[model samples]
Target: MIPYVRDIKFEYGAVDQVSPLIRRVVANNPGPFTYVGTGTYIIGRGEVAVIDPGPDIEEHLEAILKAVEGERVTHIMITHHHIDHSPLAAPLKARTGATIYGCAVTKVVEDDGGVKTEAGYDMGFKPDVSLCDGGEVSGPGWTLESIPTPGHTSNHICFALKEENALFTGDHIMGWSTTVITPPDGDMSDYMDSLDRIRVREFDTLWPTHGPPVREVTPFIDAYIAHRREREAQIEQALAAGPSRIRDMVPVLYAAVDPRLHPAAARSVLGHMIDLVRRGRVLADGAPGPDSEYRLAG
Candidate 1:
């Protein structure tokens, strides 16, 4: 596993320590884990664009306002409309009067098979302008293209800065964890295509919604692609060993995977098994559901 300290960068109504143009303002609700609620940062230009304001903490929002004290904040961009990432958009707009931009899929009210994140939590914020693919946001010296990167969520889009050579990759590609392709909202084909898009693009840095910026991005993207491919092989091997269940494949397929993250690993295995069934490489007898089972297809 790649281990790195995710330092936050704070400046101008925005917090830094995350990247050259990125910042992380600590939120109120840290989250379900020990090291959580690190929030997110703004990317590019003196008049910046904030990505994922994080959970709604009055202090955090106030800190953001203070961080961007004198700067005329132009835009508030949503990475995927996830609560932990976006809840502050509306409130911040009330505070700073900046236009919010995101995708239709993101602000669609429900995320990931009707899972309500913002409702239970106070992190709900909607966008003023929701965009689709190939859209551009131009300011005086900065221009960001809305690059569609639908995988972690169909609404998930990354922002590409033209002049600065940076991409704000929401949860699409983070330094800490492989993106979870949780079905319905997430699609494997779209995620792979998004990875392909990054491989062919020219970008010096990556500002992800969650983790730290990957200074040299292309290599990390390549590595992500390789990681996914490797996982695919591992799944197939686990299947061929004999008839199996997600529980059965866990040890053989992800023995080296973090024990604490087994449930997540199981989710990935579910996606893999679904794909394998489609390709006729494996048969499922309720392997992921009641009576679900799996075996070598051919």
Candidate 2:
């Protein structure tokens, strides 16, 4: 199991202090992918840094503005350019004059397979300061180190709060569920490498944008990695029978999952197939994709 944390106590639009140096204001956007909604985090006091300002709903914008009413928002940090995560940054920046930092927008736009309607990428998002892996940004009392973990999206980056030893994992390692790796931009090879990268880091806690905090950090990450490996194993087993399309394998691979989510599951399976093809473990008819047929390498 992934040691999922589902229950979070918070009223929408109200700022709740989650830790000594961190406070969260939940946006009123909830769904299958968003869970309760986007938990926009405020780091440090007085001169603070806001992480994932969330969607562009007027209420959400007002909530964030109210939360930082008397404080100076020195920095606006984005994890990725997803519509839910980065759309509010522009308006927030206009209001606060804060420098936007984090990953740049992905240039390539592939068929997201209906996943875009739920949580699409915000192509207009461009950071004033692009922080690569090991980059650092600071405020009055908090310093966040950028840990680029680009499996969820090519530009997805996690911010680590040095003072609290807490990592703000965007969609890379959500506590509520496994991340959806939609390809072309979302790669399984890169995602697995990113997982291993975070696994070695001794972080005290993980705060995902969409859900509550993850306290048992190491075990949670271990289980996440194991789950992916298990899925890969299942794919391998399925391939032993014959060449198969991602859509064909999704039903058997994700039988327990909601049928509504099978499309997303197929995209994840496509991610695995891309990785398998790269590693020479599986052979694809053409470029590995959602519609491509695959078989175990001879």
Candidate 3:
């Protein structure tokens, strides 16, 4: 009998086509929040732990408030400093006096708002309580644990709700698309390591940031790992074909990748190329250009 429930949108100000994996009603935006997910995890009528209180949409925030109407919200836990995920933190806190928790990745997340001219993000909200890897905050019906997942973003934190045996994977592992490994902020090497780390953890479900919960955890991990390996091989093969730039491998490396995410695909390619150079498998001199070209190490 939850009354306050806001319908989050999937389509947004930026994206034209909504991917199948994303849940809730949300739009892809030039704004800070692109995809707002559904299924609220309220701890109690008044006391709830909102995993990602997306966008500062009055209606969206109001729905959350309405759902917990007559109840006092105690927590606002952020998985990362992504503008979309953390933008509403401040407003929600001001209204409910809920303690906000997020990793120390805000400055990087706000990146001078250069991309805002392009990505259209409404930069708002900041965490009040900082949560570290393996940190826990317990309240009424839930004990939320932060699991540092560095890949999409170095400070990204995944949450585990002990009572439900559920791991809320925010962009750490998504059902729709392969999470991007954007340089500086996101690290490919760290991503693979985190993937390996999650393999051994016991969890009944994986509640992804963007989509529905994954029922079978291990197979999804296997699929994710295999998918990554396949992409890695593709990168290597693209290199062996001749002197290839990241753009040259774009079509081949991301055959079925969404065109809207071509930039992200480019970012992943850049990260992989850097990793390859480190292992002495490939060679690089500098950023994208003739120097950005790559070939077999030997």
Candidate 4:
């Protein structure tokens, strides 16, 4: 079953309190991938830390400023370098003098296609502080501990809010839809590993950058894991039938899915095939691409 999202009326630039410590301002950008734009989270009151300032939109900046009126911003923590999540940090930092923090610059593995996917990258973003695993920042009543969970992208990190028993999951875990694992930049191996990493963490609520907050942490993650595994099995079965190209596999595997989403689905299929190749369960005739031929391993 697909994940269900909470009903959130996204009025652009309006700050809504999600919890006592968390207020959200949705950016104006929304689409098939970005369910309701990006949910820019304001953590803590008085002196706050803004997580995922979101897409450098002026109105979003003004909304965030208005949310923390009569207060100061201590730090700006981004979950990852996704465009919809990180661009506004510069302006916010300029206005509030808050230190911006994120994981180090991403080092991606190039696919056989020899083209890197710039799906969610913001080239101009440079975090003031680069966090290591278990790194942390503190404020009046809140503390954010960075957990390196590279899956959605090589540099993706999930921040755990100590005060609220919550985790800012970013694209690693979203309530609206399954994350797009576009290969070369997005790895199935890393994504699965990150999911396993999150499974061991202590977080009651998962506040994703898109969609509403997920309260049932373990079950939701388990479902995500199962979904990927099931998709992998479907791909494996398809390969067992005969030699197939990536395009040929998409309809066979995702026949029930919207044809419009097939391009995205093909990437995820390629990601899974790459993982299977690494595991010696599948054989790729050449660098895996839309036209690459595949068959079951001997």
Which residue pairs overlap in candidate 2's backbone?
A: none
lDDT of each residue in 1-298, candidate 2, tens digit only:
7789888899999999999999999999998779999999999999999999999999999998899889899999999988889999999999989999987866568653466524877888999998855599888878999999988888999999999889999998898988888777788899999989988988999999999899998999899999999999999999999988988999999999889878768878888988989999999998887788899999
Task: Report per-prediction Cα RMSD to one decimal.
Answer: 4.1, 1.5, 7.2, 2.5
| Model 2: lDDT to the true structure | 0.89
Per residue, candidate 1 scores C-alpha lDDT tens digits across 79-188 of 77566777777888888888989875542333335322122222244568877665888765677788878877777778887776888787787765567776545566
Write down the RMSD of candidate 2 (Cα, Å): 1.5
Residue 281 Cα positional deviation in candidate 1, in Å, after optimal superposition: 3.4
Rank candidates by lDDT, best first.
2, 4, 1, 3
Identify the runs in model 3 with alpha carbons over 4 angstroms from their true place: 1-40, 44-46, 106-125, 255-263, 287-291
How well does each candidate superpose onto the true structure, as a TM-score?
0.81, 0.96, 0.79, 0.93
- Where is the poorest 10-residue window by lDDT in model 2? 110-119
Mark the regions of model 2 whose C-alpha exceeds 4 Å error after superposition.
Answer: 110-118
Q: How does candidate 2 fare on TM-score? A: 0.96
Query: What's the true lDDT of residue 179 in model 2?
Result: 89
Tens digits of per-residue lDDT for model 3, 48-164: 677777656676677666656677878888877665566777888889998988776643444643222122233343567777556898776568788888877777788887877
**Residue 197's lDDT in candidate 4:** 89
**Any idea how many clashes model 4 has?**
0
Best model number under TM-score: 2
C-alpha-based local distance difference test score of model 3: 0.65
